[model samples]
Target chain A: MPKVLMKGNEAIGEAAIRAGCLNYFAYPITPQSEVAEYLVRRMPEVGGVFLQGESEVAVGYMLFGAAGAGARVFTTSSSPGISLMSEAISYIAGAQCPAVFVNIVRGGPGLGGILPSQGDYFQATKGIGHGDCRMLVMAPASVQEAVEMVMKAFPLAEKYRNPVMVLGDGLIGQMMEPVEFPDHLKSEPTNKDAWSTNGMDHRNSKKRNIVKSLFLDPALLNDNNLQLKAKYDQMRSDEVMFEAYNTDSEYKGLVVSFGTMSRVCRTAIDLMKADGIEIAMIRPKTLFPFPEKAVADASKKPTCTHIISVEMNMGQMVEDVDLSVKGHLPVSWYGKCGGEIPTPEEIIDVVKSRIA
Target chain B: MQSEVMFAGFGGQGILVMGKILAHAAMEEKYEVAWVPSYGPEMRGGTAYCTVVIADHPIGSPIIKNPKHLVAMNGPSLEKFAPTVKKGGVIFINRSLISFGANRDDVDELAVKIMEIAKDLGSVKAANIVALSAFVARSGIVSMEALKHCIKEEFSNKPKLIPLNMEAVVAGEKAGKK
Candidate 1:
């Protein structure tokens, strides 16, 4: 198929449709509103359901209801909006529902600027909701990667019977790039009959399928918590994804980044390489099941002396890098918040200052 | 090879669309391309700009600090971006709006009366197309033919505008080639 130019937001919406997710519930938010807008027009054309809920809170539950009923459902929002959806997200995770959520993050502590920022990294990968619930968060670095991740999110969500998040900063949501949806990523909708809320008559079974997160009994709730923990452990071992660049040779410093910030690191690496400075990068594709081992191994390399985590936020992902490095090498941090993206030259300067 | 171009002007001057068309044409030519616009508050009654990166290989970053080519459609845009063009880069100015020339001596600067040409061609709305044609002709970033095809496709829904846009392209190309 010929590639077409598409913004990251619209491409994700189309990719979800191609992935066979017919139900979409969302509220309009900057940088990500295009996803909802695109779906509003395209979903009905494909005989799917598209609804604009009153708020992010409503959309979260709408997704919960639709997913509980065994439909492939998804929603998109920005930083503040995601905060509004947190309680419902916690419930969905506690209930072990299969749904996809996309966060085209914007800057924030509270009502942050509308520009792109990875400030939601901590919110997303850590403490997204209350209780012991974890989401399989995938961060895409490019528009094409965003498309592929969105298409893969559905199956991944169902496979774990858990929520999956496609995390992208505002740049990924707003930029236009040429993309082609790969046919291999397309899959038939998963069989939801096993756990869906379809009537007993629809399933033709004697047992009832009940979907709820309320477990009042202490022992029973503990059991549910243990089950969720086990799933997260399995994901930690099996679902970790990352990409390493220029790590083969000796390096004076290693940079850890994710999403759009990784591309800036790539350019910085190239510039430093041209000046005879050896620098490598590790980009984590999955933020939750972070590429801890990769970062640890890269940090242990004989020539690697220091590590730095560059992000769009003040220092969210550096904590993860610090955990991965674990005293083998020092992990430094550099970032600009409030939607200000650091340029390649700026990153190069940071590397110089750190490694010098 | 890679060409990093920035198009800048007032909000309603179609600066973003110019970059989009260039990006679309680059995609048509099978080049890896990215178009990033200055969105949000700056887009409402303020300066509007977008960067288009066209490269044979994948683009590393869409946000460029020093573009190799700049299409400045107004005085403020020209004043702000002319110094940021890479050394030995090209700056295409809309002579109809911007009175001053580029201050840098190392770069190649070309000035075209884009708005005047578009006005004479019967639609001042086509000024962006004129400036885009001038940039492509001057920089040879994308072929004139590919650009024309992209313009026609961009206005495919409103077919009547294609002829006027094409005329603007030819007139601007003539001035740019000179």
Candidate 2:
């Protein structure tokens, strides 16, 4: 694998092409429009289908249409645009369709600022649409990770017969970094023959495959919910990932963060390490599964004195961190709303002041 | 272990191109690098800033609030970023666009007329590339050979424009020599 300098948005598009995603449908939005633009030019050259729908609403439906037919389908959008696609997202999850959605997050309550923000932590993890369905949400911190996650998302979505959401903010979407594309990926194309709505023929005449979430029977819905829960449980056991640094020192405190915030925390750690005020971070890569056990163990350790959750929003992911640590250690929150990314020095100041 | 620098200025000032040159040089030195720009609506006729990180070790954070080095292309950028430069850090300013020099005594300042130098060389469009050349020469931030290699690589895809940009680089370096 050879590393190439690529922007986060362009990396997502390139990785999807290399990952064998032949179908992509999206509408242009801020901080994420590059992903669509890159695909529009590259998709055709790779024998892939790229369509710009009438709007995000229509694009989500197109994703559903293609994904229901078992094609590797995806779409990219930001905060407000993601809001429009939420309804269709629910439908895709309900039908157990394998679709990959990328959210290059921007700040917002409604049509908010275009700066990077992580305020959608809850909207991404807590089942945005409705019903008893969930998405496998992966948070990428860098352009390289963003590319790799986009590639892995297709198979993960198919393995569970669910939607995989690659959630990032404007920073990750806009930044450029060097990344290596794998030469050989374990080929796992969509099971078109077994599940897709392509056609029915002499292959199997006993029964037809209809993909939908609608269940008329109440008992059947209950069973479906249980099965989904089981899938989620397995994900909890298998998919949690985090990076910890300088935790073994005479660390007085811990900084719990994710996505871009984690990178800031790492910088703060580098600055504060010399002062003997050691700080460590637990960055949750998968927000849906929430890396509970890893966080719980870190927070419960006797050497770890206190825990603080830092983010770009006003305490969305902090709540999840709070839930994980619980009463084992005192959990605090710090952040800047409306896409203000806190600096390392500011974060270190807050940690030093709070923990001491 | 890692160093991050942000260069910010208005569009057409060559802020992004400067950052790209530094990134290219860093990669040539066998170091980790990333160049991220403010694009789309924020890029058209608006202020543009880019974060460029170069490190012997893997860079953990790409965003730099208090950059180790600051290169300001205009007055607003200097006013906005003067206080954020790390203590004892160096700041290079384009005196042609910015009237006020670095007032703080904590950091070293080099105020050069980058646009004037580019215009004197018959191309005002090369102002940003000139500023980059100045930074490499005066600040010695990246080596001259490294900057030249980066310039060669950047224009490799667009071979026709190679001569003009390379000329801009030499003009910038010559202006910063004093």
Candidate 3:
């Protein structure tokens, strides 16, 4: 496909249609409302279902219902809206249903601001829902990457029978860039007949497929949790995706960042390279599978001294970095919680002062 | 290899659209581009601005503090962003609305009466197109042919507005040469 200038949110909406995900349910919120706005207009043209739920909570259950029936379904919401959808997300995960959620994150524990932020890092990767639920979280630094990740998410969700999240900041949702939606990435729902609650007649006379998260007996609940844990373990084993930048040769500092913040760090790395300062960076494309081994291996560089986690939030991802570094290198966190993104100069200064 | 332009004006003045047109033109020239807008609540009824980053390489940080050029549609926009333009870069001032100078001697400042030019051309709504053409023509960031194609494509839906906008581009490019 030819490249077109598109906002990240609108590109995401178009990407789902290209990916053959015909079910979309969403609630309007700042920064991300454009995703719903775009899909509401485009879905009908493609003979797809576009329903704007009353709230994010309703949207979450709507995704669960559509996805349970083996339909490719997704929704888009911001931080606070995601919070309302958390319960249903947990239920969807518990039932092992396939769904996609795009969180174009805004600021705060409450409705702190409508600008971009990575404060929802923990919310997306760790606490998307209650219980032993985990979503395969993908963080995209650019609009093009968001389109690719959104297209890749449906197949990944079906592969694990789990929810997959394309986590982006408000900037990723609001900014416009040239993006090409590859024709090859179109995907159809696969292998859903065995477990989906699609009508038995549709599946060629199979036993009833009950899609529910509730396991009344304690042993069954434990078994279900163990089954979910196994899927997550498999994700860690086979689904880890990451990108390493400027890691060749020896470097004094290693920076671990994801999402929009990674692009800023990338610029800082380029500026520092020009100044005869060597710094390597690892940007996690999949925040869930987390790319722990890549961070661990990159930290083991002989010339590396310390690591810094630069994010838009206070210190959420730093804890994970510290764990990934395994205390071999001291991991420090620097960030701004407000809507203001950390500048490239700020990142360079922090790495120079803190790494040494 | 990389340059940024800031388009600043009040909310209904097509500030974002101006940046988008520049970005589209740059993209047509096979350069990577990103268009970032000030999406704060202030866009409701306050100063609206957008930054267009055009680079030969993939853009890293979309947020730009100091842009390479400026298209100030009003006095407040010029007062706010004119100082942020890099030295030796083109700064397009819509002199029809902004009365003051850019106060910088280091840059090539092109002051055009964009509003009056557009008004005389048939509609003041084409003022953004006038300013965009002036900025593109003076800065040489993208070729005039590429920009004209983008302008034609932008108004492909309403073919009626294409001729007036094409005239505005001609006038702005003429003004930019001065």
* lDDT (Cα atoms) of all candidates against the true structure: 0.90, 0.83, 0.91
lDDT of 1 by residue, B30-84 (tens): 8999999888766377999999999998789788989999999899999998988
What does the i-RMS of model 1 come to? 0.8
Error of 2 at B41 (Å): 6.2
State residue B143's C-alpha deviation in candidate 1, in Å.
Answer: 0.6
Each candidate's DockQ? 0.82, 0.60, 0.86
Pairs of residues clashing in candidate 1: none
Residue ranges of candidate 3 with Cα displaced over 4 Å: A184-188
RMSD of 3: 1.1
lDDT of 3 by residue, B1-178 (tens): 9999999888898989888888999999999999998898783769999999999998999999889988888889898888888999888888888888899999998898888899999999999998888888888889989999999999999999999999989988888875
Stretches of candidate 2 exceeding 4 Å from the true structure: A184-190, A201-207, B38-44, B104-106
Clashing pairs in 2: none
Model 1 global lDDT (CA atoms, 0 to 1): 0.90
Q: Write the per-residue lDDT of candidate 3 for residues A197-289, one digit (tens) a residue.
A: 877777754577889999999999999999999999999999999999999958999999998899989999999999999999999999998
The 10-residue segment with the lowest total lDDT in model 2 chain A: A183-192
Candidates sorted on TM-score, descending = 3, 1, 2
Q: Model 1: per-residue lDDT, tens digit, A293-354?
A: 99999999888778999999989899999999888788899989887888999999889888
User: Chain A TM-score of each model, in the order shown?
Assistant: 0.97, 0.96, 0.98
User: Highest TM-score among the candidates is held by which one?
Assistant: 3
Q: Candidate 3 - CAPRI tier?
A: high
